[model samples]
Target: MSDIATITAAPIGSFTAEVFAAHLASLGDAPAWWLERKRAAYATFASLPLPTRTNEGWRFSNLSGLQLAGFKVERVDPNGQLLASPFGPAQLNFINNTTVGDGAGARAELAARGVLVTTLSAALQSHPDLIREHFMAQPQKLGSEKFAALHAAFVSDGAFIYVPRGVEVPAPIVITHAASGSGTAVFPHTLVIAEENSKATVVDHFVSVSDIPHSALRTPQFACGANDLYAGHGAQLTYLAAQNWSRDTLSFQFNSTVVRRDARVQSLNLHLGGRQARHESHSQLQAPGAFSEMLALTVADGEQEFDQRTLQIHQAPNTKSDLLYKNALRDRTRTIFSGLIVVDSDAQKTDAYQSNRNLMLSDDAEASSLPGLEIQANDVRCTHGATSSRLDPGQEFYLQSRGIPKAAADELLTFGFFEEVLSRLASEPLHDALHQLIKTKFKQ
Candidate 1:
């Protein structure tokens, strides 16, 4: 193991050199390789500067709202409080970077079938090879490299899931990450690996818990999270992430997906919280017959700002990828959607589509879209577009005339607008769960 003294001392944001040392000390008897990786990641994070206005990757972003100071990493007790999930007993709950519950009995059947569901700390000691192979394996191409490195440096424990070849899991594994207390910072991660011909579903819930009343002062928090999903040849994987942090929190999430030959992967993200939140997703089609479907829905209200960026890369011939993102902006909120699709020279017969749609509910709201395509292959069929529109007065009036109040009418219209993306889900239960969550946000 590398000596802690060998690492140079430096501070970035509220994460100081002392903080990093304390975090390392907390991980008693961790593998040497993992400890060394954290040291290097911290070095990289300190050397890199925060994103500025001149950075093209952060265009139209509220750069001033990207504050990382005044936060500390600490263990928070949830006072016997646990948020309920809509799905099965296969659930893991974490509060303030500490694991509070693990549904072992609920997962016994799947475990007997060669499925692995455990914390990253446990996986580091047992399945070291798998952890080393797929943990943040992809490069940070979406321009949050600094924050991504910081996450790698400070991440303590997260969920790890592995499915062996030809095994099928019937229930969706749920992982919940909650941040409690003011000025608290938490790093949450989930890594999923589905072997050849295997099948599985995983859902992640990001939320906040506080004693503060909703109408009173809201808690301030910081959350930096990332996830990696890999589907082996002919495998099937479905992943969903629901983020509902405190309204005064600042959040960042990065996602990377890899699909192998004849494999299929689908991911849906629902964003409904945070004073300012940014999400980046990248999907790579690495083999022939591979397919990826990426979908997201965001509800930006008040002065909230939701920034989303995505990339679809076609690395092999005969690969397909589809991405659709929808955002509903109300009050004086803002949203930015920037996406690009890249087709390699050898990736002929590639079929790719990208679209971003925004529904404006207030005249003061702002929506910005930047969609681009870069194709080195001449035979590829790729399209990209973005549109921003408001609710039609006729439609709103028609619903109101039928005895529905204006607020109820608007809620109904918004659900109608979001159905296109929700209807694509293969599981009706998951779809309804997400629908109910979004409806709760509307009511708030």
Candidate 2:
């Protein structure tokens, strides 16, 4: 076989040319434009090489354990369970890339108000032009271009939401991406387009179905997902993603947000599971008065590795952005956070802030942070910092003096450390849910 043929003939990690072809064929009668795009994307994915330890972007990442060969692309018939609590106004549940839950009522209600909440495939058939215009429109500024290409080439199904101008979605839209079956690979996508003066909130949940023990050999799943948010002039958009994949799963999530003139966006990511997980987020202030608030919380335990990278770009004058990330590390877990803020020459009066804090609960746990800035404008107000500290001994002692057990007291202190980032969410329900999730992680 030739070089290209050999690479495409067999499984390369979890993706091969044969698998890509099968995925495309499964789409049966998709739009020609989209099909062509997938073909091109596959070509790109096959040609580019994976990240290496020497790459600056992949620094501090667990490059040794990154494997992609044993997974297969197939439909998984998972016994999926919907969230116990009320998710939101609209909830779409998926089992291995297939929407399995009923969202008819929510869809009907939104349809009456000119909102579109449905599967990406349906959107392509009904609104091809809109999908074509904004699908993966933002540049993948962070690393993981190769994986992004792989996602575009093999993505089978996901959620599509659109809010027309002047409409405000009273309740948030929810999408659940669940994976099951041993050695299964899934690609979940979420695309949101908010028109001028429109407002909406979207929450994405990533999970894996199966009661397998948290062992390296018992469970292994591959997840590559991406989300795009486009806020038109004066629009308001809020997005949240909570990932709790299987402990033996390899997961990747890429996010891009574009804020237009006078528009604002707030995004929060809660990380709780995965053996080796990497998340990349990029936010762009495209026009003046644009503002973006970025927040993230993570609970790293056992031998898990959580790698997060972010970029904030002030492309226009008078734009602003704020970012706060907090992580609690226990056992031998490892976490990495690298963020950068860039201001263009004309982006004067750009007010930006970035901070990452880690609370170490174990002496062996590892945490690394790289926060930087690039400014071509002299009149910009930008500040960035990263901090890693252990639990305050004095506070722990004080709690113990009050009759609280040492273990419970430590957990309380961790919650207090995370409350700073959790309090930024305007939705009380979301805040509470996240708190409960973190609390559960500690109990485990």
* Whole-model lDDT per candidate: 0.90, 0.87
| Tens digits of lDDT, candidate 2, 1-444 | 143344344325667777788888899879989999999989888887767655899889987556677888888665655444334533677878888878888788999999999999889899999888888877787788888888888887889999999999978888888887788888999999999999999999887776454432337889999999999999999998998887888899999999999999999999988999999999999999999999999999899999999999999999999999999999999999999999999999999999999999999999999998999999999999999999999999999999999999999999999999888888899888788877778777
**Model 1 clashing residue pairs (backbone):** none
Residue-level lDDT for 183 in candidate 2: 88
- Name the regions of candidate 2 deviating beyond 4 angstroms: 1-11, 78-90, 211-218
On residues 216-316, what C-alpha lDDT tens digit does candidate 1 reach at each position?
12688999999999999999999999999989989999999999999999999999989999999999999999999999999999999999999999999
Best by lDDT: 1
Q: Which stretches in model 1 have alpha-carbon errors above 4 Å?
A: 1-11, 88-90, 212-217
TM-score, model 1 to reference: 0.96
